[model samples]
Target: MDAILTPAGLLQRSAPATDAPRRRPTREEAEAAVRTLIAWAGDDPTREGLLDTPKRVVKAYGELFRGYDEDPHAVLDRVFEEVSGYDDLVLVRDIPFQSHCEHHMVPFVGKAHVAYYPAEGVVGLSKLARVVDIYARRLQTQETMTAQIVAAIDEALKPRGIAVMIEAEHMCMSMRGVQKAGVSTLTTQFTGVFRDDPTEQVRFMTLVRSK
Candidate 1:
């Protein structure tokens, strides 16, 4: 008969292998993949309008999904502790972000509101926006994007708490698919004290909503 195992033993046995991390596509590989996708969409990739499209798209994607190449941790590596004893909520709002929805490959344009209570340090206001762009420029779901914004800042600043809210209109919903016209989507993610505390969360919401 097989011996019974403790939860820790079971977990250890079930751990994922670390031998191989997935490889990213080379530039040529990426371009080829895009060309194939263009063909599959029933468009003449060789047409005058599209003759150079693959190259252009590959370049565009290099910029769009460049987040895949960057480490979010590194993006927030440095921190500033010269708060001058100012410990109130630090709010950065109305940061414009443009992203593509992974499901439909359509655009979503909107603003991100990011805030955090510093534990020991803080990051530049613009870095927060850059962090938002790093995540937004990729194909992502609004939910994940919202969480990533909060998580990146949380990691960078070691904040007491972090709140991120995104409100955007998706072209996938407006232009095609369900075609909801002007309907917009809202997604929010809270971490640390923001998740366990009510007043802090409400204040963050009120501030962002005022925008």
Candidate 2:
């Protein structure tokens, strides 16, 4: 697992990100791939300051992409049925998340707003936030992540209605591409009552923006 060290830096990926992984690159292989990227980016990975860079980068990537190992449905599995007769919109706002863009591999950081009307029971409020984190920790588009959150909750909780909105700033745009700073992209998804009634959508938005 030792060689002259690759200049890839962090350019190479370990394996295809999917539920079923038949094979994955070894740690040395991953580091070498990073070294390959460093060389591609015009940096000498063997330099004194850069010697440990590949290892650090690989470690950081593991945390950033831990979502791949998580089960979204499991987060909502423990629901609380005792609502005392409560049946209305349950909103969890401003759940901050960081995700990588599938196309560029740069980050898109933002906050997510989620809400749902209870059909049978309710999940722990924090469980909603956990769901957001599960999807956000993966490479994704804001649009797909938004729908995925709604779908996960819908299937696990069987809620009467669901609403999810995400607003993010893609680093690919700010750090590269057009280089327009502070530009935010927003995405949303709705189902059941929220999808059927415009007023409910308004209500969800109002609560999210309030304070």
Candidate 3:
């Protein structure tokens, strides 16, 4: 996929592709790095209480960043064209996700609301959730994550239009600098007809805001 900066100044992927290849550290190497961090924080990594902490952290990292192991396009490859002429809007809202911030390695928890206007086909509703999870499992920024979700569906499904909005609380902000607890960050992306038509955009917001 190609990454582009949207008008909102968010990084967005244009198409889904296999994850890039990179040299990965071995488990021992990862544990050693965690040990270094522990010592840097003035903790004795070798102490009886902390001796296994590095190992545990390394294992946890594997689960936390498993998005690298997945191909989002694969999840969206299956399309069902027999919609029986039902083509309005397919929206999946309030998809809960957890991701670590790439800059701080701290977590941000959020919900994503995804909507697409089908041109001729539709995929399973669950597939949209899976796409969100595939991206959420990686280290991210909320703006970029929102754009990526919309891009994946737009490219794979060729939808008439797509919209994505994400609302999140970043631990890096709440637990550290400025420490404004309960504050939320919001980001959105729109494409195709959703970008050209103001009424459709308003309708999308209405549907999203409706209880």
Each prediction's RMSD to truth: 6.4, 8.8, 4.0
Displacement of the residue 210 alpha carbon in candidate 3, Å? 1.5
Rank the models by lDDT, top first: 3, 2, 1
Per-residue lDDT over 115-171 for candidate 2, one digit per residue giving the tens place of the 0 to 100 score:
999988999999999989988888877776876787788878888899999999999
Per-residue lDDT of candidate 1, residues 26-99 (tens digit): 87887788779889999887789987887888898888778777766777887888989876788899999899
How high is the CA lDDT of each candidate model?
0.80, 0.87, 0.88
Residue 84 Cα positional deviation in candidate 3, in Å, after optimal superposition: 0.4
CA lDDT for candidate 2: 0.87
Off by over 4 Å in 2: 1-21
Which segments of candidate 3 are over 4 A away from where they belong? 1-21
The better-scoring model by lDDT among 1 and 3 is 3
Q: What is the TM-score of each candidate against the true structure?
A: 0.82, 0.90, 0.90
